[model samples]
Target: MRLLLFMLGRSIKPAVLITVFVSVVSCVMLTFCEKGGYVFDKEYDSVFTSLEADTAYDKVSEMADNTRAQNDDLAKRAGDYIAAHTKPGSTPPVLPDGLAGQAVRAAQKGGDSSSAGQSELYEFMGSSLKDGKESEQLIGDKLSGYKRNARRGVTDEYSLALSAVLTRDYEQVLDNQQLADKLYDTRAANTYLEYIENDMLFFVLIFLICFSSFSSERQSRRLSAFAITKAGAGRFIFCRIISAGLVCGVCAVIYCLLQFCVMCLSGGAGCLDMPLQYLKGYALSSYAMSFGGLCIAAVVLRVLLAEVLCAAMLLLSFLSKRNITAGLICLAPTAVMIGLSKSDNSTAQFVTCKFSFLFGGEGYVRVFSTPYPVVWLYVLICAFAAGALFITLIAQGQRREY
Candidate 1:
């Protein structure tokens, strides 16, 4: 128990920290404008102007006039009725002793922060003042009109005008369009970046583990000692590989969960089920990266070289903006293997790449469709990695001298 606890203490702490950092960083990027609002600052304001510029202002102005008049009358009654009404042009209606306080309480509660509640009340007032049969017929007619308009792909201009009333500021139409565009597309871009980051987490984990584990051992001559031990080379190599890969996998899962949580919180449940294909691809890529990193580190034999190589790969990947390194590490070989082999247009062909590291690949099919050849290509890479690890183990076993 204590030994297990020690291992967990060593492993889970860094994993948790990495996951939290990824989540927080992602959330900040998502909430703020990154790379500027370049996409949104382009298209939507025109749509807003077309929908809302003219009719909205006139209706809101009319409503504002009516509301202002009502407020002014109420203020005048409160201020002038008791003091000036007794002697002036006309006497004001006297309120009952408790009526003013009741009205005050009603006003305070009635017009509370939510404007939706106030609008609902006005709607209720309008409904109540109408005849029941007429109201029912009106509702039926409106429903039919709504269906017809939906079929015709037409929008209600009055609703747009009413939106202006609710919004109050003419500029808000543009602001809302910007907000909607930002919320929809820019946020999606951030999520795409996040998916990339999350998919690349295995790579990050590999770098961290390779740096900390192998470099430390190499510096301490621990690897040299292990190479001379009874069965130590194989056991030590496999154990460290397993440990590092598992740690990376766990961290990837936590990061994924944190990212999904952020996505759900910010974007609502609509993003919950977006692009399953991309998610699958991401998972495939992530796992392949983790396992491939372990094999690469084991094969390289020099801890410092392994670290340098991994870092260089990552840096090059980011800088190149080409899909080559990403494809290599992301199990593109698997996609190749799946495609090059012959298959019927049957159930076997409809395999979904199940991976936890990256999101799914971006492909959709209604069964009988082969996943893209790219997917199989990544799988083949993973297979090659496994084969290389086996060869490395055999080579180490054949070496007589440490």
Candidate 2:
């Protein structure tokens, strides 16, 4: 226990203070989430806002109706041909790659003209809703729902633009839950983004952890003289990496718990009911970002370089509008296991909350898969373990110059 405190003490109090400050800030900002709805802000509201409008709805509906009428006219002609060509007991053409062949393949795949027809019907219904009856009712219902949940007013211009998504035409699906599900999906994505963009303190905590860990160690010569003793370079290095990683893990846990408490107080049970899967997702994300910092310290012999690189990597993960922190964490072990993979910016949309992996947030909707967390976390921990071995190897190889 004392040893653990000693290791944590090696990190300056400013780092601890930074973590606390971030936690407080995370709580304050996330409070606005209750009334804010899912939209990021005025600037990017278009990303999620539906694009249907009264004028455009009418036009689309009219166009769909006209197109369906044309298709109906054509279908009648085809029906006439079918009736005239068949004999009492004769089969039709078996030519491959023809319309009939295409029909047959589509049938095997459980899809065909029926599927196309249904899609066309949906499009037609949507268009008719814009141009036809109940247009005003449809617009009102959508706007009311958005306004009730949203923190701010959506502009009239954007609201009019997004009318299409809300105006559905299908008679069959008009009663179905498809629209509800779609709205939920959009909200889920927006909720995730909202948490990511607002968690500035999470980023600050990460930078502080990395910078302080290395700088403090350098000033104290804490890792010194492990060289002259029987403490193998491998064991000594592993200890330092583990020590640093554990500190990061503690800070991350505190950050999350504090945020969770704040979320509960401000938003009530609705906020706290964030599913278990997302909780696990948050844990994995914290480990990935934290471990990445630990590994950086090992490679760059100078603590300052290590600290700067850690800060830089955290920033880089956000550049592509997709999180790649897990992937970067995975590379930690690669440096020694098979040589570091050429670092490149490849964006991925993970099933679990990618933000949870990148920062400590409790606002995830659904858990997609656990394999990503398990696989990457193991790989990252291994990287830190390998970094420990490398340090040990350095200690053993270069004897004292006495």
Candidate 3:
């Protein structure tokens, strides 16, 4: 315990605090200032310039266009093909590359002429929800860890939770033109799509911070000296993992609180339980959420995820001789996750989304709609990753002399 606290104390040096503070401030300011110069000011103008208004209008129009693009007849057909290909009593088919599109186009011969991408997007989401349940079907047999508990949002038997998800997404995306414009008028001051844009830099910054966990210690050769202090390798690795994770988690909390303070100041923290629309099909969900609820949830999950990832970084340090080598190994994946969240910024810049969408808030509607705190499958992946890395590093550490 003393060793753990000591490690954490070392992790929270002034350098860490200063870097985190500066990074958080820079990101929040960059994002918040772009949203028409802060809405909380009493002297704030209640109008958009001609350019701003035109930008908002074009954004919505482009959103619908993008949705239409992603959800062409081919995508709709592909979704159906994927669904049809599934076997009820067997594992879902893991197809070869482009199989979905191949099957979809092969099956369709030009049926519906005037279709919207929202419909196809809904189909894809429904397929995903079904796929998740099917994947969860092995809980009792092969997968003991994934029991069906309603409190955890898991059910042993199949459930059509996808219907509710589809409905919500549809409602939010099909907003009347008037409401769509109102959502982006820069005066409404809601935690809708535009609000999330202000926090993108903050999230990317968190990803960067997490990527560096243990790099400095490894570079400074402290690990070798620390290993000599009367500790078994297993005990040392375990303590270091915990210590690093805890330190990162605490730092993440500090970052989150800073972002939230900025949110409150800029009027981004207004509604705790208001309906939200991502307004873009590239987003994870088209549904609504308690705007504030989503932010809080995003912050908590993203922060904890950073900790787990940091532990993974520590494990990498044990394997790689160079800190830059270890750091790059971690940074590559963070970059990919961030990239997956990207849409054409030119079109999406005014809409205020893509960040949280990439970070796991896309289907958050259904996650919150349920009474129990169900662990998302992606989260389960993180848990598995954290556990695997910690164990692997511990085993490796055990073979070395302290």
Candidate 4:
């Protein structure tokens, strides 16, 4: 038991220090970052109109009024586009330049059209037209249904926030054509998630960090020495997994705490009562989620995913002798996971399988209304990860030589 404890402690020392450094760096970035605003000055504009000009104020007001009118026109066009293309089995809508050209242009401010098959503008509009309206209507209907069934003031908190947001003229928001299009698209609670989505990059970094962790000793040929210790091969393998799991789990917790601290410091921390949201260009309307639901789901998901990745990397380390091969195998899900994150067509959250890491982020992002199912999914995935670790332990135990 002492030997096992010593090995575990030795393995996690470096990881703990690394976590502290990473958390400090992340908190520093948050301390300097603007709430829901860009950290870089890439969009800085130097040219300015002189306010001394006689007609400057008039010109600006006129421009604002004209822009407002134009947006109202665009909103009509968008509505027409949605009505026309959303038929059963019909192709998704693509608004003509004459229709939503302005909205598309606004959403794609940072996107380049010439470089890709489909520009970010196209993707944003398509997602907005497809999911934005559906989300809005879903919340509205749910709120109305609950209102009819429940006594006064006994309504769900999400329903109240959702109804309040929906009470605002959604058409007006779409018409104004904000750069992010967040005006009409997201639930109030989703604002917090949207602000922190960039934080997911850190999660990827964590995965990469853990990927090399198990392979390190094996590459150094020191793993064999430890396997023949007084604890025997089985204990050695299990202890190694325990060490990795502890490291990964602790890292996940630290990352989450640091992230939330960043959110709080950036003035976006108080979104618990807000509803969950879907991304169009930004947060969607109506599809409110309970903030509590989203928080629990996201935290649990991160921990489960970190542990699973650590275990998988351990198995891959033994299955393939080449570090590059094992690392690639461990990273096989990155692209697919990203794609699933952006897509709403993923299979049910409860259907986690071998590609559980390829599972959608929405399962947590939208967990306000889907708490139980997604929590169960996380539990199931963790179980599978444990099973995989046990199998790895047994397989490694059978081998007498490195």
How many clashes show up in model 3? 3
Order the candidates by TM-score, highest first: 4, 3, 1, 2
Tell me the TM-score of each prediction against the true structure. 0.37, 0.35, 0.52, 0.53
What overall lDDT goes with each candidate model?
0.39, 0.39, 0.49, 0.51
Q: Give the per-residue lDDT digits (tens) of candidate 4, residues 85-136.
A: 7878878777777555567664554543221212322332234234433444
- Deviation in angstroms for 331 in model 1? 21
Encode model 3's per-residue lDDT on 241-287: one tens digit a residue: 77767766776677666656665655554333333332222233333
- Candidate 1 segments exceeding 4 Å error: 1-9, 33-190, 193-205, 227-231, 274-373, 386-402
Given candidate 2, what's the lDDT at residue 372? 28
Per-residue C-alpha lDDT of model 2 across residues 122-236, encoded as one tens digit per residue: 4633522321234224434544665554436555543433322223212222333122222111222223234633344554465556433323333445435554566543444
User: Per model, how many backbone clashes are there?
Assistant: 35, 20, 3, 9
- Model 4 residue 66 lDDT score: 56
Evaluate residue 122 in candidate 1 and report its C-alpha lDDT on the 0 to 100 scale.
Answer: 35
lDDT per residue for candidate 1 within 1-402, as digits (tens), equals 343345556867775686577657755665453323223322223322333322332433444455446555666666765765466677676765554653464455244422333333333322222221132233335445545655675555554333323223223322322232211122333343434332333344444433344444544566568778775555554455445444544655554455445544543334232222122123112111222232232222222222333333332222222344343443332333245223433232322222222122222222233323333443454545544653453444345245
Looking at candidate 2, the ten consecutive residues that score lowest on lDDT are 337-346
Backbone clashes in candidate 2 total: 20
